[model samples]
Target: MAHVLVVEDDRPTAEAIASELRAHGYSVDTAGTGADALALAQAATPDALTLDRLLPDTDGLALLAKLREVGIHAPVLMVSALGDVDQRIAGLRAGGDDYLIKPFAPSELAVRIEVLLRRTRPEAETVLQIGRVRIDRIRREAQVAGEPVRLLQMEFKLLEFLMRHAGATVSRRMLFEQVWNYHFDPGANLINVHIARLRRKLDMPGEPSAIVTVKGEGYRFDAV
Candidate 1:
């Protein structure tokens, strides 16, 4: 579950993009105004961004410069109607990670985001960190604030699940299928009980809470 920052001025379009990303277990933060979009981009701590070319307050290219100036180097997939090669080159010069024309498939948007995430991930860092929590995939180790955590088999799988989807809400059904590999009845409440226990260890007021429950949905990793 990746955290995505979406900067689109149109509300309907923003909602559509957010919904599509959420369906695949991505946590998305959207802004309609360029000022707000820049602010959100600075705070989103995203693994990527979906930005529109035309913005209300400022052009998207300028915002891209602002993002780089502030040191937010997350991969970005720019949304533009400009099809000219020179315009695309300008976008790249402005620090856009990728560009897409308007009137494109929602599925295509998702694909581009994934490609950037895969390509931009550093090869030397197999271990991922979100704040103080760390996951060492090769060693099968998860540490909390630098301390070794002793987890049951199920807990390890649950951590792995959240780590894979670091930001998006993973519905109960998806969790059941992917993490448990058990698509049992919807009546099953095992996920909730385990989640509560994990919360006690991870997010008890003074500590950081890596897991966030998305109300009617399921859960997400919120490590900013």
Candidate 2:
């Protein structure tokens, strides 16, 4: 899965973008300031970045230059309220792969980041594997222990999301948003029912379920 760093000072906007990216299966890290963003980028380079054009401490262009100096050459999608042609050009000239004007749809932002990632990493993996399970994204197939596993459309999507986030806790709300495309929780056992069916198919007799429930929080997919 692709990893993206979101650098935006606006708390609500940052959270909204981060949530949207996470729902789309990209691991995301958020920073409210330039210093924090630089620190995060240095510690663990992201595949791409969604940088706010106007940060509180420094101009986005300056931060971009700093990142380059430190050898972090990830593509950047600059987000700004300045939608004027001149401002957009400046952002592009400053190493922004793309510029998104404010008031834009979060879905569109995700797509733009995806496009950037594609351009930079054309060979991104299409198949996902964890332990004995494997899934081909292009062929829409799943296997456990080298044997085929039949799955309905919805079940495949759920499994894909879980596999992409292997070893991480996935919230029920996240599953609902990403898998079911539902913005609000239905307040039902819809996810539980589907997951139970999936567990039965993927689990071998006398083996533990791959998906583990984290009481009061959500489910964690054990990589093992």
Candidate 3:
């Protein structure tokens, strides 16, 4: 079970959410103030966070900035009644991974929370090697040859996922759904864009490309 920190000022509302999440078998901690929530997050480092936009003590955006400054990398899902596109975009830009408006169904909240948690921690597999590049799943780290290599957020996730089942051809549909969290694209160029970025970054300086594109199928990474 994953731990979730939920920050909301309303006592009844916060308890209600915590109760629902706990019923779903998740460990949940509730905070009624931004200060309290930040303290709880620092102490426990919950797997993910559900932040309320209106905190009695301080601006939620400022609180989020403080959390980011403290290196809290857990995915954040913002709860707010503000449904304007600008507000939503602002939340995203402020490091919120997802947002749900007030009056949301408990089922929707539960599903979204599960998705965020899963995104944080995927199914663990053994070490994956694609050509000369090796990735350790537990650490979510990659290496080219013997030296370490750093990957962008999406790049690392995409590569980590492919390496899990090296040599098994994976369809773009599966990749988009599993990696990008988007399963509804009629045709997604996102796969192509991320792959190209990964290729340029990973296969540079005499490095052989490990990602293979299968026409009419999808892509696969082969361990060599």
Candidate 4:
């Protein structure tokens, strides 16, 4: 069963969230303070974390920054009563994989958690193949058709992420978090620039492109 750490200062609310997750067959740990959450995260890194924007000891974003500084990359769902656009941007800018406002149903929270867990789960296969492109994760190499493709380090990471999700839509923010490991947007078209570079290397003559843009959503790697 997947484990989740719930960081909420309110005892009743925390327990309620834990119970709901438990009902869904997930093992959960609750922390009422940032310190406890940090300790638990270090000791037994949970598959995912549901963090409250406000904690008793410190700001949740501060704790999240600390976790990221120390190399904890587990998906985090930041919950806050502040539902404004700026607040949501702040949460995501602080390294959260997703953000949810308060007054939400437990079922909605559970569904969001499920998606985060699904995105972070490791794949069993070492070799990933999509269309005529093949990625050898173990060797850190990629090949197109019968030819070798030289990819930069970042390019390789980007390809691996897209291939792992195959047909799933991956937002630019998601790519920034997972690949760059930074929460805040780079304030430019850096992701697009990188994607263009990868596309140039991956596209072959007379072949359909492997990457597709989901209009208004994100990018998806064709499963074919």
Question: Considering TM-score, where higher is better, how would the candidates rank from best to worst?
Answer: 3, 2, 4, 1
Assess every candidate by TM-score.
0.54, 0.56, 0.57, 0.56
TM-score of 1: 0.54
Q: In model 2, state the lDDT of residue 59.
A: 90
lDDT of each candidate versus the true structure:
0.78, 0.87, 0.80, 0.85
Q: Which parts of model 4 are misplaced by more than 4 Å?
A: 1-76, 81-122
Clash counts per candidate, in order, are 4, 0, 0, 1
lDDT of 3 by residue, 12-70 (tens): 88888888788778999999999999999999998888898889999778889999999
Q: Give a tens-digit lDDT track for model 1, residues 117-147.
A: 8777745766878767787877778787888
Candidate scoring better on lDDT of 1 and 3:
3
Sorted on lDDT, highest at the top, how do the candidates line up? 2, 4, 3, 1
lDDT of model number 2: 0.87
1-224: candidate 4 lDDT, tens digit per residue: 99999999999989889998897789999999999999999999899999999897899999999988877789999999987889989898889989877866665576568769977775578898888889999899999886899999999999988887676677776678778976567898888888889889998778767888877667888854
Off by over 4 Å in 3: 124-224
Error of 2 at 39 (Å): 0.4
Please state the error at residue 222 of candidate 2 in Å. 32
Please say which candidate is ahead in TM-score: 2 or 4.
2
